[model samples]
Target: MNQTDTPDKSDLSSISQAAGKDNACGTNSGTHLSRRGFLKRSATASAGILIVPSFVVSGLGHTAPSDRLNIAGVGVGGRGFSVLQAMENDANIVALCDVDWRYAQRCFDHFPNARKYWDWRVMYEEMLNDIDAVVVATSDHTHAAVAAYAMSLGKHVYVEKPLTHTVYESRLLTRLAAEYRVATQMGNQGASDEGVNLMVEWIRNGEIGEVTHVEAFTDRPIWPQGINTPKDAMPVPDTLNWDLFIGPARMRPYHEIYTPWNFRGFWDFGTGALGDMACHIVHPAFKALELGYPDRVQGSSTLLLQDSAPMAQKVALFYPQRDSSFGRLPAVRLDWYDGGLQPLRPEGWPDGRNMNHRGGGVLFHGTKDTLVCGCYGADPWLLSGRVPSVPQHERRVATNHQLDWIRACKESPDSRTETKSAFHEAGPFNETVVMGVLAVRLQALNKELHWDGENMRFTNISADEELTIIMEEGFSITDGRPSFSRPRTEPINAQAFAEGLIRTQYRSGWSLPPMPA
Candidate 1:
């Protein structure tokens, strides 16, 4: 694994070009921008311009303030309802779509003026002109299909955390967002927290010396395992659109236990503890240290009831890239613990052991000092003996993550802080944490896997083969393959095994846009 910390310049450039291309503006004419016109438009813009569009007094496809950024909510239940409530404060909620009619009915009651649809595709097709943004808070399985389609239609998106169900899906969504040139934000609201910003500055300024190791822990074993639960095929609920719910997954009989909250424990629907909490817990360390993918991930834990579910106590080791700008050290090691697991105390920190609480958070150990953080590592308090000269830092409470997103959407991109909520920053953080889920999957298969960060694959060929087989029986290729790797026999969807990218099957009239030429 070539764990080097340099962004692929070519890839960045392509992203820039994609973002610069003009979007299909009007509903009537999809043929407005010719190839030459697109090239001309792209040539006149700088990379910054790609993110911050110049105000055009008036032109074709130009969005009007009165258009009101028509918006839709894909899953308007629980957290989805919260997302809808947040969006209501900013943009018009023109449509509400959900597989559960009950959820949709509740949302409809809240926004009586908005159109309601049990299917997202119907909502999009019928109200395409009315919608300019989409909020996708559906189950992991349905994320890719809805988000991909929304992006294809030139709509801005705010998808919930863990950005995608699988690695392939994450990269796919990122690519489509760039290609569509629409403003995007992931659901990792802590990315904009003041405390997280302070943590990054402290680490960058060497307040904790050269950070060689980090440990993040979470208590996410609340969901019961589905193992040994008799596969009693029950009739689909009257309010549930079962087929739409199963959008891309291989079909399975309906079970009440698998719906709503319980989906997190199932391999076919969710990525378990790491996927559920990694995005929140790992953000502070990843952003502060500027770490990329890990070189090798090894995990050890007690298997819970479900064979496919993540273990109760798990630890993932991340070996940082040698060329990373975050530190001058040759390499760094990061440990992630969850399900009540705790990190071993550092050599001299008196209160290190005291910081071992349940829930989720991160611990940083440096050559000279240590620091412990809370709220999924988004908030931190320095704890060490070597910091006599260091100044005391205050932590800020982030009352609302959604407000941060709304504020960014309403403000100029350049005016926003570097720590502003952004997919570029948030996406990588998600990738790092979700790796723990992948590690759990590998551990379940009883394979010791070595990762090649530059190649984004296992260094051991046999291990790689085993990973491919376990991911999708025979599917080997991944859409997110690093530029330097050899192509796999299968496509990206096959590589996204448990991410649930392929879990939900769309209804008759719904389909993802064909991959762009």
Candidate 2:
């Protein structure tokens, strides 16, 4: 991963002033240092002055960890590797696990002392004493299993965005994290950027008037929909433990396409375009608007692939509860367009201003103005009128997401620079985006789902029943079901809504721990 470019010194200084600290950082107060003081001390500290110790010993601090934070990483490839690299400067990597040993082997070269495991469960049990935190960056299907297990052990966690494979898993994760009181952060690192926060502050201050609607779009295309394709099952490479790669995912014939990056488009392992992009694209707008559970969600999509395949393009609509803060505001409707799909622009915006980029982004339509921003959590550049200005505020931008998490792990939760990193704040955002994923999946099935957020089910009785039947049929209404089905032991946890379904199982001896009571 490329190093994050350093902002101008003047910009940093301005940010520090706005933050009211030498370090313009934000996190939960219990687990953070005074950013101002840290920056001040770092500036004068000599080469050998252990950075973390200087802050701790001086008590220029608050609550500090009794021991150094130990971190283990699962899925150390792609984004996972990036996160690991980011954390390397601040935390000790005690263990590394990946289904594809080859992928993780490269990472081990960097941390020669860390134990390596093909299965995360093995890492969890064997490295129990060596790890205080875990990073879960596996495929969407395995997110909940890894994270829930980690949190259950009272380990702090940093899971990738879109939280879980299904709404049920999302709820389970949130509950378990709360029960365990683990510090948690989703991998929507953009949430820590000053631009995203500025967008939130802008909306909170009504810069564009009360937001009534939002449009988010992504250019992601569906591919490698599943391993059921004609690709010949190849011999498992010696460097990779094929059985482990199928973790939590049902037993499947191994295909080369399923490995590396193509898994994101497959229903069995990933969330497709909606799940892959919505978390980053819609987060700022969702947070800025203080949007909560949607009253209803509906979706439409083009069936570009076979019934067994993931959808190529889709659109989802979320109708949120009315808010008095915006004055009898209309239910905020968020439109998500993915897989080269695009929403019709609001009536008055310039036609040509539409973004041509294939990546995803969000557009907020308020009473008096429209705001368009880049997809993938890029900073917002006012697309229309000047946003109402407020008093200058501090801009907290973390140089590294992993480092931020390490810093949080070392401090009490109350001292953290921002609370959003915690599951409470990140959960809702994940829920909202993942809901969009569920809606898209339903649309793919040509099912009309009328969601009742409070009830967390379709109000249409028949549809609700069909949903249960579908689940029984070995297909998850949120995430697609595996090619096979398991016996239904208990009624599906209707209350446990999940956008992605965890249908696959890990290789033998690599099962995730049961959800803690």
Candidate 1 CA-lDDT value = 0.59
lDDT (0 to 1) per candidate? 0.59, 0.61
Count of steric clashes across candidates, in order: 13, 44
lDDT of 1 by residue, 389-502 (tens): 434353343445655444334433344322244666665556566566667655544655566644445555341332332221122456965333222234223234332322
Residue 145 shift from truth in candidate 2, angstroms: 1.0
Model 2 global lDDT (CA atoms, 0 to 1): 0.61
Which run of 10 residues does model 2 get worst, by summed lDDT?
23-32
Over 4 Å off, model 2: 1-68, 222-228, 304-311, 323-329, 346-358, 392-395, 414-419, 444-447, 461-517
